[model samples]
Target chain A: MSIQIWTFILVGITFAIYLSIAWMSRVRDTRGFYVAGGGVPALANGMATAADWMSAASFISMAGLISFMGYTGCVYLMGWTGGYVLLALLLAPYLRKFGKFTVPDFVGDRYYSDGARVVALVCAIFASLTYVAGQMRGVGIVFSRFLEVDVNTGVIIGMIIVFIYAGLGGMKGITWTQVAQYCVLILAFLIPAVAISIKITGHFIPQIGFGGVISEGANAGRYLLDTLNAISADLGFDQYTQAFGPNSKSMLDVAAITLALMVGTAGLPHVIIRFYTVPSVKAARLSAGYALLFIAILYTTAPSVAVFARYNMIDTLNNVAYEQAPSWFKNWEKTGLIAWVDKNGDGKMEYRAGKAIEGKPKLTGQTGIYGQALVSNKVVDSNANELYVDRDIMVLANPEIADLPAWVIALVAAGGLAAALSTASGLLLVIASSISHDLYYRIINRSASEKQRLLLGRIMIGVAVCAAGYFGINPPGFVAQVVAFAFGLAASSFFPILVLGIFWKRASKEGAITGMVLGIGFTMLYIIQTKFLGVGNWFFGISPEGIGTVGMILNFAATVLVSLVTKAPPQDIQDMVESIRTPRGAGLATDH
Target chain B: MENQDRLKEYWRRNLRLMLVLLAIWAVVSYGFSIVFVQALNKIHLGGFPLGFWFAQQGSIYTFVGLIFVYVWRMRRLDREYDVHE
Candidate 1:
């Protein structure tokens, strides 16, 4: 079968399974809609959490980023996985014990103030929207490339499918569908990795193959990292297998970025809410462990994939004659993602370092200025023979680059779609619950009936989906960049407040509110100035990605300073904190 | 008075365990991977530089192990304090 037909068949089958699950598990009450009735089993909830956590960034863009950035990319791998440790030990079980329907529930009740709840609601909605926009864009990219449709049409199709499952089934439906998504995405990620590993190192395991010596090729008997390092040096890039020091990304920047990602993962309302779906506090703790184990399966494999994909691209394209290029090269070129200019009129492509030459001859009525076959539109640079290859193509084009079979490429398309859809549904649920449960039921209509709240939740999901789809069509940045901003905002605004509310009994409503406002305010201002305004030189040499760590520090300082001056929380609130610290009476949501 | 002391003791032990485990997490991810990375790079493990392996692969495996260890110890602690859920 053709690759396009196979993609359609696999994607169609997966969508059908998701829709059926959504139909069967249709939510009946506010509890089901908001928290999946708080009855999801540990293993199943673990799978759901893994799916919810690994968004399009993890599935599609992470390996690509790692391939280009090399060792500096370790910040993402360590930061993301390490956060689960904090969640399992410091946050998850405690939140499950204090559980209501949403993150705001804890903030509101713990501080004994509706003011704090509103702050948390706003943060949750803001962070989740930023994250979900990236997921929607990812879905559109996969659809447009594989299904041969325009980007907007592809986005609309994805929005419709997510609306069906998320709007109808709520958390209950989303949970089951996520379990299926985890299976598809993991298999899709692994098959290519394993195949390439065996091809390179004669090993079945990618982890071992990463460090094994290549058994064939010109680099035979040479260690994989040794070969990659030599190739990178020849291309004027840093070694692929060494840590960044004074010459590259600073140690402080690495430390700051890693910390920000860890805290941000713990703070994300969508991921934290996954813990509330489990039946018991013990299950919440155990489920985090299971979730990490599941997430690790992919996290560990990504670096290997990055190394192999980098090697393949360099090996195939370096110094090759333009006319002798492979079919895959031409296919990617038509999409405008790969461009080359024969500056010396040598009729050969040069893949090297430094800036491409500028202002070459136009291709209107001219021929043979460079080559008879090469046109101006195909060559972006005129003066120098430079090749521009987009980093995002690394993973999507990996199978073809390795000459893997067509069916494997089709499976990758399905996997990318599954990843984006599952995460989009999860984030939309958080946004919907924050509006319907926190803003509407709790504050606006304190006496709203269960049916009214359920109806409102569904309505909010529809509206949120439309907004996310619009952003996907006009994405502000790349998939991983937008996600990094989401993480930064979440780390700054929610993480410090949540930690203080539980761990410090004297934390007051005034302090929490002040802390959240200042934290989010500072982080947003930094991101806007640097990202959109093109401002150079961040404060203290920290990148915008690591500025959230500074914001978090300011938040903690503000909270602590404010709380010391203010009166302590009420006796009941203090006692509530004490009870949440223990594991007893955790399954039931009671206020003692 | 006796019940209050037992509850206090349980909470204290839990906090102590958390402190100890979190310390390990920090040392592996931040300390080995970043702060001491240059020093560790002098040593090679298989085909990987020691610090590079810790940053990219070893830290993740340690995180997974840390979580399971926390769960197992917490379960036993809960039972000892009659707080098992």
Candidate 2:
């Protein structure tokens, strides 16, 4: 069967499963909509949290980035997983004990100020919107490539699917669907990775295979990392096994990026809200452990998959004849993701080091079946490399690259859609609830009925989904880049406030409000100045990816300084803080 | 007075345990993986440089271990404090 037909069948089946789960778990009230009625089992919530946390970036783009960036990419692996440690220890149980439905709810009540709640609401909306945009774009890419639809149409289709589940079941619907998604995505991720590992190292476990000796290649007896490093060095890239330091990324740069990612992961409202669904503080803690364990299955495998994919691409494409290239190469070429120009008219492709060549190559009179130019303008310069490959293509094309069966490739398409859809729905829920519950019900109309709140939540979901779809159709940047910005913003705005609110009894509402504004403001200024205006060098050599660390520090300082000068929170609020610290009587989530 | 002392002691014990676990977390990720990476990479662990392994795989395993340890110890702590729910 054709790949498209297989993709359609697989994708269709998965969507049907998600829709059915949504229907069965349809929510009845605001609690069901917000925190899944606080009855979710720890293990199930763990799976759902894993799905919610691992977005399109982790599923589709992380390995690709790791493949290209080498050891510098360890920042992502360590940073993302390590944050769960902070979450489990410092935050999750207490937050659960506090029994709040939303992150902003905790912030608002703990700070005892409407202004603080409003600030948190804006932060949640900003972070969630930025995040959902990336998921929407991820959905668009999967549909456009696999389902053979236009990007915008694919986004609309994805929005409709998300709307069906998220609007109907809210958190309850999204949670169950996410459990199914976790299964699909993990299987999709693992099959190709294990298959590639077995093919390369005679080991089925990717983690061990990463260090195993190559079994059958000419490099037999060479360790996988050694072989990869040797090949990458031979091709003028840095050694794959080396850490990023003065030669490439500075140590401080690595540290800063890692710290920002860790803190950002903890601060994300969507993931934090997952803790509220579990029934008890113990369950909340256990769920975080399970979440990390599930996430680690993929996180540990990603580096191995990255090494194998990079080795495969470089080995197959380096100095290969363009005319004799594999069918998969030609297929990807038609999508304009991989391009080559016979610069020397040697009719052979050279995949080597150096920047992409300047100027466009003359196109041959070749047209695809869709009546589009088969090979759009090839970018060629006087460099040795004649091919320009998009980083996003690494995971999607891995199975095809290795000549895995069509069904496996089809499963990948389904998996990608599942990953993007699950995260998009989670983020959309965060946005919807913040608007409906925080802005509409809490602030605007304290007397709004449950029915009215539910209605507003559904309507807000519709609006948020459409807005996310718009961003998908017109993406401001690459998927991972946009996600990094979201993380940075979340770290800057939310992490410090939440932490201080929980641990520091004297943390004043005025302090939180000022800290958030200044932190977000500084981070935004830096990102805009660096990313958009291109004005000055990054401060302290921190890329915008790591600027959140600086913002977080500033937030801490501002909060501390402001709180020291301001009057302390009242006696009752201090007692409330003390009560949440102990793991006693953590029942169903309720407003204080 | 007795109840207050018990609560204070419980809080103190929890903080101490957290401090110890968090210290390990910091050492593995930031210390071994970043600050002392070059020195650690000079030592080999099978096919991987020690620092590289710590950055890519070892630190994450330790983190998972740390969390489980925390959960187990905290569970016991909750019981001791008569706060388990």
* Worst 10 contiguous positions by lDDT, candidate 1 chain A: A357-366
| DockQ for each model | 0.87, 0.83
Q: Write the per-residue lDDT of candidate 1 for residues A178-286, one digit (tens) a residue.
A: 9999999999999988888888887889988888888887888998888998988777777786677334677788888899999999999999999989989899999
Cα deviation of A308 in candidate 2 (Å)?
Answer: 0.4
TM-score, chain B, predicted structure 1: 0.96
What is the per-residue lDDT of model 2 for residues A125-206, given as tens digits with 9 covering 90 to 100?
9889988888898898889988889988989999999999999999999999999999999999999998888888889998
For model 1, state the Cα shift of residue A280 in Å: 0.5
How well docked is model 2, in DockQ terms? 0.83
Off by over 4 Å in 2: A245-247, A358-382, A477-481
Error of 2 at B85 (Å): 0.6
Q: For candidate 2 chain A, which ten residues in a row score worst on lDDT?
A: A367-376
Reference-based lDDT, each prediction: 0.86, 0.87
Using DockQ as the measure, the top candidate is 1
For model 1 chain B, where is the 10-residue window of minimal lDDT?
Answer: B33-42
